[model samples]
Target: MPIRYFIKQWLMPPGLLLLLLLGAWWLRKRRPRLALACFVAGLGGFWLMSLPLVVEQVARQLETEPPLSVQAWSGLAGRADAIVVLGAGRERGDLAWGGQDQPTGTALERMRFAAQLAKASGLPVLTSGGLHYGTPPSEARLMADRLRDDFGVVVKWQEEGSRTTWENAQMSAAVLQPLGIRRVVVVTQAWHMQRSRWSFEQAGFEVVPGPVGFLGQDHGRPFAGLLPDNRAIWQSGQLLNEVAGLVGYRLFY
Candidate 1:
């Protein structure tokens, strides 16, 4: 694994929270006051991260792109030339699927929505993603297969060399722009559309944001969402990662 990956894991929640707890343990005898602070910080951070209400509130701010209305789906052809589905990642070999890798839930969401859009607008489709950790069968390939088998939509293009949002735009452009396709509708998680749009625009394409899988709505959980849930931790982590990505893109890209 790359050092950057380790660095990111340590800096982000769960890992960061673990460090705080370890600090509390190490300082319990010597620096009692500081130890207590670390314990409180770590525990409180975990508590906040596991709450559904916190996830909804934070995701609402990040997911600013509104969903495309059903009434406008058929009219998308006039607004763009192609539909691009951004890959989210893949689930490694599973016995249920005969050990073949499959698209992650996030990727499936994009593909499902992209399929509907493609069918509605009669636009060709492109799947954008690269290999996972340098493995074979890139995310694009996995998405293409799923889209064909499950949704009955054949992908017109597969940009299989991008590992990040910036690369997704640049690489997809390399394929589409050569074919005189300069306008496209991009499909991804609602929270990710902002960065995806900015990157595609920078890569010299007119972008139509096609956001899906919104997390900023009421779940009607017990106790009015105040109760902590395990899934909330993952959701909160995604939003935090997006915030970090947005900041990193502004600084580095």
Candidate 2:
């Protein structure tokens, strides 16, 4: 794993909470008051992460991009030059596909939406992502293959050297700028649209947000909506990461 990944995991949720719990255990008797404080803070953080409302609120803030109707999708080509499906990740070789790399679930979600947008608009597409953990098959390759094979849409551009959102925009610019494709229909998850839009705009594309997989929702059950759920924990983690990225992007860029 990368050092940055480790640093992020340790500094963020679960890991940080675990460290607090360990501190509380080690100093329970030696420092009773401090131990109690650590225990409370650790458990409190965990509880907050486990709630669906927490995920909803964080995602809602960043998912400011409005949804595009099917009617509007077909009209995109009139306003936008092409479709840009931002790569999420690859599933790394799986036994089901005979050990071939496949698009991750998140990647598939983006592909599914992009497929519709492309089919409706009849526009060329671009898939952006790079290698993972130093692996060969780039994320762009995986997305391109899936888009062609599964969706029957040819990807005109494959940006295979970008690892971050910032790089995605910068590297995509290298491929798109020369072609005079400045107006793009940017596709990604609704929660990530903010940073994605900022990065793409910085790269000089007039962004037409095509946000999919909205996260904010009401679970319908009172306890299930607010209680400790494993899925909510993951959503919370993703939302927290996006929030951090937004702040970092604003500060640095």
Candidate 3:
């Protein structure tokens, strides 16, 4: 639907890499040199990205924040005012869930950690997300519902008009600042926490990073570490997207 979405999907791996491979195949006979170059670039990029260890190394650049200690998590009251859970995009209509859009895996992971933090901290929560391509049932609503129904935590505020992390901070600021709540615990993936913290601080909040789903940790999964995996490709894509966002936000924001 959106031009930028198309450009991004095409630029990222599987799209660009696959296109290169196809182009190589098409030109192999007439344009031997060009085809060889394309084949090497495409196959090389794909091969390098599919390794689990490679993903962790790149992710480590952004996954600097660590999880809270058990002692710190055990006593979280007075640490902050509320938990601000950032939204990941939702899954489109699915027959399994009665055609209702559901929270994406990343969103659910953030919600899971936020729930545990809220329960231990005695804090209220807010879900920040806007519509998907101007569609109804904003990500905030889906997140609020999941937090309430699945996690037993009532969302106190739903900042339902932010599509980017910058907006997440600014819109949440508009809602929270008016109420004199300037300190908050922001919850998101560890790889996302750095940029999330910077944006929220820019919007005037004392941010407490509540990072979850820590990545880049060596797992020593035998040969699986070096082998190509579909999931690793996806993970690498996520990390690359974050890197792009970090650079773009720093330049424009």
Stretch of 10 with least lDDT, candidate 2:
216-225
Error of 3 at 9 (Å): 1.4
Task: Output the number of the lDDT-best candidate.
Answer: 1
lDDT agreement with native, every candidate = 0.94, 0.90, 0.90
lDDT of 3 by residue, 54-159 (tens): 8889988898877777677646667778889999989989679999899999999999999988888888899999998689899999999999999999999999
Off by over 4 Å in 1: none
Clash numbers, per candidate: 0, 0, 0
**Model 2 over residues 179-239: C-alpha lDDT tens digits?**
9999999999999999999999998999999999998756564675776789888888888
Candidate 3 local distance difference test against the native: 0.90
Q: In model 3, which regions exceed 4 Å deviation? A: 26-31
Evaluate model 1: give its lDDT. 0.94
- The residue pairs in collision within model 2 are none
Shift of residue 73 alpha carbon in model 3, Å: 2.3
TM-scores of all candidate predictions against the true structure: 0.98, 0.96, 0.93
Which candidate number maximizes TM-score? 1
lDDT of 3 at 106: 92
lDDT of 1 at 110: 94
